[model samples]
Target chain A: MIAPVRVGQAVRLAEWAPGAPIELSEIPANSAKEFILPASETIGRYDRDGARFTMRETTPEGPRTVLLGVRPCEAAGLAIVDAVFNWDSRDEFYDARRAATTVVATACAQADADCFCTSVGGAPGATRGADVMLRLADGGRQFIVESLSARGEELLRSAHGVTEGEAAADPLADVPVRFSHERVTGWLAGQFDSPRWQEFSLACLGCAACAYLCPTCHCFDIQDESTRTAGVRYRNWDACGLGLFTQHTSGHNPRADQMARWRQRVMHKFSYYPEKFGMLACTGCGRCARMCPAGMAISDTCRAIDAEESSPG
Target chain B: MSIAEARDEAPGVRTFRLTFTDEPARARFFGQYRVGMFGLYGLPGEGESTFCVASPPTRTEYIECTFRRAGRVTTALQDRGVGESITFRGPYGNSFPVDAWRGRNVLFVAGGIALPPVRSVIWNILDRRPEFGDVTIVYGARAVADLVYKHELADWQQRGDVRLVTTVDPGGETADWKGQVGFVPAVLEQAAPSAGNCVAVVCGPPVMIKFTLPVLSKLGFAAGDIYTTLENRMKCGLGKCGRCNVGSAYVCKDGPVFTLEQLHRLPSGDM
Candidate 1:
């Protein structure tokens, strides 16, 4: 058996077994984001010899990784972050990692109360960022696999034990559309100073677990750590939930309170990310709601906004 | 060679004049920079600090940057010597829309280390005096010793066309100080000029901006006529590093320069 990597509500992915079942109910705790944008990576290294400084760029060199059992919601999250990493200045490290990975995602069989993929214009079987999409065939005894990308075709071609079979009906979960993402986005654009932000964020303990566990939260920080003569520049994951995110050196914080910070967290994902990248920054996986320490639910926030008349776009 | 010259502009701020030992690097640097733009100034092992290009774009011989010794990158920059090589990544963000203000009265308001950004435009306008109309500069610092560009201020004061007003904050003025003695907003209100047919560019800390915006409004300056730059803690001068956003606006990409009206439209006042 291959080493299994378990994530999101104890969802596990083991080595392929022809008759074995795939975990389709639980959303994985960790995302395929680790395969592309790792938690920590060194971008450059610098050393000083006497009075001279010499620096070397750190290039990506790692084994080609293949991720299996990624849900459609989880897979789609990668595409949102991709727009940012490749937007203005192309991040070679992310590019290199992206080129080296192959993703195989599974359609969901069931969704919980927290799941709202349909609300965000995603379906349980959406094939957005996956190389290949798999659906349960022959009553969970076999997977009806279809190639979605050139990489998926290549992987399927090189496989040893697979046999061609008719496409099975996708057993997608019934994920109700709780709110219209566009409507929520429109409402968020005008609700910057709304009291709902305070009301929604009242129970927030300032723990950043939501952003940490989110599949699409891609903010980062760059720093340098050095010895007497040598140093390395590292880019690490950062979240907007922290108080220090926008604090200036002059001891002034633009985001002065939890209300503003929490407002940023929601606005960035719902309003700003869509405006800039033309895609919502959320994947509707509901991991944030499931894992929130304060019981803060993103679905509740979306519904609250959806209940109001949105600003005319 | 590095650090050709350095001067203490204030208690914690220092101005560094630097040169590139590499010919092509220096050539590339001059070609890319514009007035009111900033650079990601750094040491190789120390990381990068964001600050405006203090030297005027007209003077292309070398670049100057003024920064307060704060945070890791600024602290490392403060320790560098004359011959040390520094890593520079830009001339990033938008430039001052100086050409648009041609033949119009131009007012520059700056405070403390914020003068570096405005200083570039100041010299740019001053270099071509006939291209603009009346040029007025109102600057203030926390204290008398905190004032920067003392020589340049004196030079502007002596000029035939330029009007310069310098001030020190309350309790900050020395007994011998002759400039206005109050906050910049109060001093500006007292020295209010006609807001008609003019453009105002203001740069300072947030509190200074908060108080000064209303004063500019009271002076009859339209929201669109006032421009200001924002400085957020930034890593990538490009929008990729991602911390410099306020609302949907990425300060690094969408702005470092924004009009008051443009800022008014943002979803939040966090900026």
Candidate 2:
């Protein structure tokens, strides 16, 4: 089983042994994005012979696998990015990996301070992107596994377990909604030039940790790494918060400062993405808030925007 | 694609006329090609850079692209000689509505380094000259040395059917310069082409566009009659890379070409 297991001080997705420890209480520091859009991947290769060159296209071969015991928010994150990769020009690389993998989401039984799934149209047991749902039952001793898709039923038929019984599931995690996403999005649409952006993003360090650990942040950069004779074109992960993300070759940047960059991050997920793609780009995984060294949280920002929306001039 | 011919336009800008080695690919490219549509030019060791297809679809034998040696890819593209191979990945994005402008007058306003995009539209209209009405081109540059497509500028100047007014900024003209000596906005107001039955295509730097739009408006041109292209920084060009967006608009997909009326709906601060 591929599940979230502790690696040093952080939790990440790894191969799970029969007796290996898995973290069910907290979401992983790294998300399922690594399994789909990896940090770096080769898209094409070329060989040059003096003035002549031959091009070679690379086809991704995705193996069949099952993601076991991921949180619902992590599972929902995949659905958000799925819309982007398949919008108009389908990304064959992302499509191949996504099509091969089956998602098995575990309903959250505990909520942490960083978790805010309820605020963003997701719940602890949401079945948005999961093929199978596993709810903890019998005081964590057992899980009530239910198939949500045909792939889930196929997985269950091939598994080693042979039990046919029913049990009442435990109470779901209590995650309070911190802010109204509708209010925040409405506020963001009119606040592109608001001074609140500067105040809200004052502590941002521009480290891009939020984007890196985010489940739905899918921006990428393409580059060629090679010697004089041969080279491979690679697609690597890129973040908008990085200073070079929007910098022109002529040395002009549209989103120049951290304030603008921070505003872009929030606006892209809440305002712009929703207007274009019909869904928010965030799944409320809360990894960005948890991993930020500067203690900045997108939920806090949203709450502030919501408060401002209710405030009278 | 192989570079058939290369020409140096400005100090750092160069143009490459490319012919496809694969016959079917060339056929496919021209079949879908249009003016204002862009392409990604690249070398094996250097990544691809996005730029407009400078040549028009009317000249179907070969396509041309003009670029400045600003970044690594453009530098590498300029370093390659004739007969050298490079990768091209476009004719992507929306294009100008030249077909819609048939039987109507067309005025083109362009500034330094921005002429390549407008040049495609100018040549497109000229190739089918009988279908369109009167044509006027107002082009300007910071200095005479910064002007791109100098040969084409001279060709338009000599054409009896085309009215070409070229300009250089004050103090930018040389001793032998014959063009008007003023800024693009000022020169455009002086030319004062009639707004009736006329559609204007404008492309320039932000400051140039900022001042020129008001001049066009004052000259009785409606917001919808003026078209311009947005030059947002892009990577994938397929809309998934997520950097080429202004507000909710993906410049690579929805634009490169937009009317002034459409631009008014978007947040100006984001631009």
Candidate 3:
């Protein structure tokens, strides 16, 4: 039932655009990585930049880029990046691309080993940051397209080649309800001086891959890029996990030890972020635990913040 | 309710006029807030720097600050043009207890760009003249070229009750210099105010304060009678950012200003 689509050119929305919901179903890709990629891979290597995705693929020049049949996690990932982009300096490169694109998210049916959304405070089929969302039914015949944002509504209005309809809410809660947030945060706050950090961060490779793969991690470093004739100063995504990440020219490294760096990672997500924005920075995407070659699992970290085994020195 | 504006004052020194960028900021500290006293400074690709509300609280709309181009963030600011879009986060840090210094004789001691944040207190005293005693300024620069608040200096000189002394180090161009030529600590010793009745506020290069303190004490100024402001590279303006701290004391939280009595007990390592 799914097919390739160009909105506004072919058919109309399955329903009223803004007021009604629109579901974007499986539209096959032109190739392996044609579109619907992270701006890091698509636009800017370190962050969102014009014509600079991670893969060096340029955003199509003329018409708006439509990433149809996208999932909610991806959309949520985009929203997480927005905070970092606007933090110290507004990255117009990231903002403009986000403005030009529409996010239509679908519920994820499968969860992988690297998935820890439940632990980090995300649900399997979450609708937190998506502009538009759709839930695929058990029978796989119809979809429940939910409009989550203004852009989602606009996309729904102009969407084409679909039947307009609403699907019943899932009878069971979509979120995996295993983790206790209060328990985890309380445990973390009290374990600041614990030795567990030393043992736990021992295996950290300092490769920064974890930060790179994360859906919410957004620290960056700016450097000047130039080849003999022309140079453009650019900022790229940076990871605190790396040893040299915060090193100063004076040769003093503030977060030099892996243990201290690990502490900052958790603190930023649970303690610091909430103190400022009244929200947690971690989305529990579980990508870091999954991608870490060292087997760093944020799940295991929950109970250990108490430093259960380590005696206070 | 408050807004941030960039007002250039000198080379590599920007007087960022910041107030509240959001409504909540105004609701908490209104009337005394300026649209410009609350500002967050960050490099385009780096991070933000926390600052004090340099504009006098009485202005209620502009918090001005002047920073030197010592690090990456300030260096980036040098390249930016006025009215260019810049992101700021706060009017962070504990402002000088201007409301408390009301009835006391206030002496604003500034060296080089250090005068920027301390300038807030100076202007406030001028604005609300009824609140405090006579004003005395002991300010210095490495060279005559380095002094900020030049044009403002002229106005300050005209005030009968306010005493002003401008100095440059001995190495400075002394030909045209009619003012004192020596270090701040040395000049403070010579221009010894009646220490018992006056509150001495000093802000300047780190080395300068290190030397100035004992001199103030020799002149009979009690440790509690003198105050100095502090600065360190900071980000997130909010204490949550964690970059601007010295020990458990986040400069953003505990202070950029400390009374000499407090400074004596504080671990020198923190600054």
Query: Which candidate gets the maximum lDDT versus the true structure?
Result: 2
Top-scoring candidate (TM-score): 2
- Candidate 2 lDDT by residue in tens digits, B198-230: 999999988999999999999999999999998
* Candidate 3 per-residue lDDT over residues A1-313, each given as its tens digit: 1113435543222223343333333221121011222323222222323222111323422225554454455556666656645654455555665667665656766555555566655665778767777677645666677787788888888878556655564432244534555565665556666677787678877887766666566655445443333333444556667766655433556676787777767766666555544556666656677667888866567546534434365
| Sliding window of 10 residues with minimal summed lDDT for model 1 chain A | A1-10
Tens-digit lDDT string for candidate 1 (B183-259): 99999999997798999999998789989999999999999999999888788878886789977778887788889
lDDT of 1 by residue, A121-158 (tens): 89988999999888877777788888999999999999
Which segments of model 3 are wrong by more than 4 Å?
A1-63, A67-71, A80-93, A138-142, A164-178, A225-231, A243-256, A306-313, B1-101, B105-131, B134-271
**What local lDDT score does residue B102 receive in model 1, on the 0 to 100 scale?**
93
Per-candidate DockQ values are 0.69, 0.79, 0.06
Ranked by DockQ from best down, the candidates are: 2, 1, 3
TM-score of each: 0.93, 0.98, 0.55
Clashing pairs in 1: A7-A28, A7-A29, A8-A28, A8-A29, B2-B82
